[model samples]
Target: MPSKTSIFLTGATGAVLTRLLNHPSSNTFDITVLVRNADKANILRTKFGIKTVVGTHQELDKVESLAEGAHVVINLAEADNVPFMKAILSGLRKRQAKLGDPPLLIHTSGTGLLADDARGEYITDVIYDDLNVEQYKSIPDTAVHRNVDLLVINADIEGYARTYIIPPSTIYGIAKHALVDAGVSNPHSIQIPVIIEASLARKHAGVVGKGKSFWPDVHIDDIADLYVVLYDTIVANPENVGHGWEGLFFGENGEHSWYQISKAIGEAMVTLGICTGPEPTPFTKEETEKYFGSEQWGWYSSILPREPGACLGMEADVHH
Candidate 1:
């Protein structure tokens, strides 16, 4: 029999979090949305008949208190840098110290921690079932991945919490109604950066380098599903699944080369009346800069091969 678990999600209304809420797994587990607005949280209760707890991003302790003896705490809140995540881990520690059993913690993170994509190191295809945890932790010390992973392990040592990380390659899924500042419109979201790369491909973008570095990616829904799957997988098979661990599911449906991306952008530019179709690839990063803007193209994100599966087979009712 599976244990009835309650999960507290920090970024409850995010593109990925939205998919998790509507997933079938949500039916089995008791979910509590942790957001900054009490009114907004209450809306989820009225709409989905689900419970939402209003809480701040930096202070997860109050949310922890609301969680009380929850089965899981899923955090996707990373404000500023790594401090927010470090704070969540700290909150769990306080919970176990004060309360009896701190919940199992699930963190939404990226694989860049394993290798610095900016440094041109990309490692893919190997499964966590085969690799050693401590070894991958050594890849990029600068990668907040190492710090976050350590926090989970530390919590486990104190018997405060069991931590799991669901690392997304590059996610491009249906952006939620409220998920603004993402996708092709903003170009900062993982979806546009990894899968679409519209700003970079249009010759409107520049490479953070020679424009050849690449990274793996997945669709946001598949990424969201993994969290739900992780919770259920553990609930049904604690005998088999380890609590203190990580799952690296790149969820790449298709691998596209950098050249292909540049070509696609060229075609789009001509179609959108931004540039002539025959215009040479990146004739000048400045020319294309009009569209993506210099600030948006600060990091040359256009060149990487999109990790496959931006759109899983399922119909995306959630708008892009």
Candidate 2:
């Protein structure tokens, strides 16, 4: 019989990771998750039968210790937490030096890194495919998600863990996880929920500018399946591992316009008697901040477009 893979997972409560935890293959591993809340920890332990370590991402020492023993470290938490990432990498590097083999580090990112920042009025024709090495290389260092992803890839090249970045597009749909039996489901996707909340509060639905900007989209289940596929491929064939698969792996199945999404939300609200009209309106920067708060204004209201060519194309094996 094959030895069980030891998996250290963060963000077990997130949308993608929640589905991953419920995947059939998840039972094949010895899983330990780091969660910040006591209630969530109890739920994960009771519902999924996974071990838990109580700590936040800011707790570097705890994160490092948990990562050191695992053969695979899957991080689905905040991509912008550079210090936490450094801690995880530091632990993996130490383990590599001692064991003479690197662990697999799967980090979550998003296709927003490819966003053109059109802020809703403009559209770009450039799309980046994961197989297109040149386009991947051309991603600007200043891109929203570039720094941490580059950090992980560079660590892989330095003989730490064999790292792969999964940059999924805006994820939708409810996650199908065992935690749902415990009456817990991962929250709805970020963009749409905020729009819904603001619409209910203000008595209308709104978008940014002309709302023509596009973002790639994928279902929560599909994103979880891709993670499992990548994991199985790597574990089954160690010889397939190298720097070649170190960078971005996108999870987009399709794309949608902000205007169309807003219109749908408006129609839903009207049908439900939450608002008076099915016609959507546009919100200015100040108005957006007033409704969604200043921090979330840009994220919920901007026009972020990914070029059509940037589709992931869903390869079963990462090497291909």
Candidate 3:
């Protein structure tokens, strides 16, 4: 029998990765996940029947060793961790040297790299095109995730690895997977929940500034299927899909302004008796930091890409 393609995956406990593992195409590939907690690793091993490596992404040597054994490396962990990416690229380079074939690296980035400093005051007219190689190259290295994106692109340019980046914006919906059922995976996404919790706590939907900042959105399953489609495309024929600069696939179906979402949340809160007001309220900078965490308030207050290219033809089945 022919051997299954080996895939080394990080962020096994995350929502997107968990849903990707649950996809039916996952059975065709040999997937080994890197997990930090020993008990979660055990559950993923015995329950899901996939290989497990007990280590964090911070462990450079361990990460390098694992990447050396895989035909593909999917990094769903920290997007901007330079050292972690460097270690993976180093291992993939060694593997390329030994096997005389370049391996594939699929990195998860965010559309926040396309963000502008609107600060929730107004929306920008610029739309990011994934197919525009020159436009993508023009993104400043100082942007949130561009440094790591550049690292992957440079590796692809050096001919050691074929690299693709999926930059998803505001992923929603609960993840359905065996790991989630086995009490191992985190089934929920991040941004919307922060809005909800903060709203419930303060008894009004929280908005940052004028809340005019908008971002694209995608369902959990729809985005997961994009990953599957990319994997299948790569396995079928590497030439069929673009790598490096041309390989950025933005995962988004629709767009929503922060004000629109917050108003809906406020209405829902009033209906559910969680809050008395049906109108959204603005959050102070300090309150935003306190409720949404110091790091995440910027996203709520800033404009992400108004239009992200859906290069692939996958239609999102779920809606807001």
Candidate 4:
């Protein structure tokens, strides 16, 4: 049977969750979002027309009652939201003992779970593929994620819910409600100011230090599509994996040098009408470092290598 209103999305109103809720397909499913307040959740329900369950994560034993007979539970639950999730999973299992079937639980995890740089490289396709998600769950650098991901993965074996983990890279998307200050500006939103200034001045946006420390990034639209892909897989088979997604993961300039990055930024500013004609002036490595406030600042210049021209158009086998 179609999950319909039986779907429960923890962190229903989270940033990524917020974007998912706004999609046109949201109405096609009878989604039940779990939040902490009836009033605020009610606003979401009124605005988005999804049911809301009010309770804290630690109070998730109460969630199963709210989720009775649910088919799928997509958790965008917070990183620290595990206490609530544990309670919910345990509670759901107990409820299922008397009720029959448990719901499918789609869990979220950080891709940073793969913390070991096998090649001492920031990130790369070979490095990414060499790391197993299951193995990644055990890496020491990702101790917290290991425990959380393990809990979700073992949910069914422990006799609660069927589970799936979505380990995401640096997620960049439009914000829903300025939930929290995200420290650094989203790279996609505004052109890097240094790049803009240098590009306009027609100079290189040089790397600040030894450019290293690769960061994985995906557009908000592509990230959202990853979920859509998951839903499609679920339609064909419930036991689908997200990291298995195939194709280009990064867009144009996924991997760029300080000079190259600056050039691209200058190019973008022109496209955005932020800068006219000339490329920006170059900054000395030290100057760049000073502007960025650390030798680490130069790391942004070193992007992971691009797969191929056409390949850049594809996304990673994120569903694996």
Judged by TM-score, which candidate is best?
Answer: 3
Q: What lDDT score goes with residue 251 in model 4?
A: 23
Candidate number achieving the greatest lDDT relative to the actual structure? 3
Indicate the worst ten consecutive residues by lDDT in candidate 3. Answer: 310-319
> Which of candidates 2 and 3 is the stronger one according to lDDT?
3
Task: Give the alpha carbon lDDT tens digit for every residue of 57-120 in model 4.
Answer: 6665577565554667676655435576676576567657766765666666654444333211
- Candidate 2 off by > 4 Å: 14-28, 241-246, 299-320
lDDT of each: 0.50, 0.71, 0.76, 0.48
Residue-level lDDT for 285 in candidate 3: 63
The TM-score of predicted model 1 comes to 0.69
Preferred candidate (lDDT higher): 3 or 4: 3
Residue-level error in angstroms, candidate 2, position 221: 0.6
Error of 2 at 188 (Å): 2.2
Number of clashing residue pairs, candidate 4: 32
Candidate 3 per-residue C-alpha lDDT over 118-149 given as tens digits, one digit per residue, 9 for 90 to 100 = 65677767777788888889988897688889
* Model 1 global lDDT (CA atoms, 0 to 1): 0.50
Q: Which stretches of candidate 4 lie over 4 Å from their true place?
A: 2-5, 14-28, 36-39, 67-69, 117-126, 130-138, 141-144, 175-209, 239-320
lDDT of 2 at 2: 32
The local lDDT score (0 to 100) that residue 33 gets in candidate 4 is 72
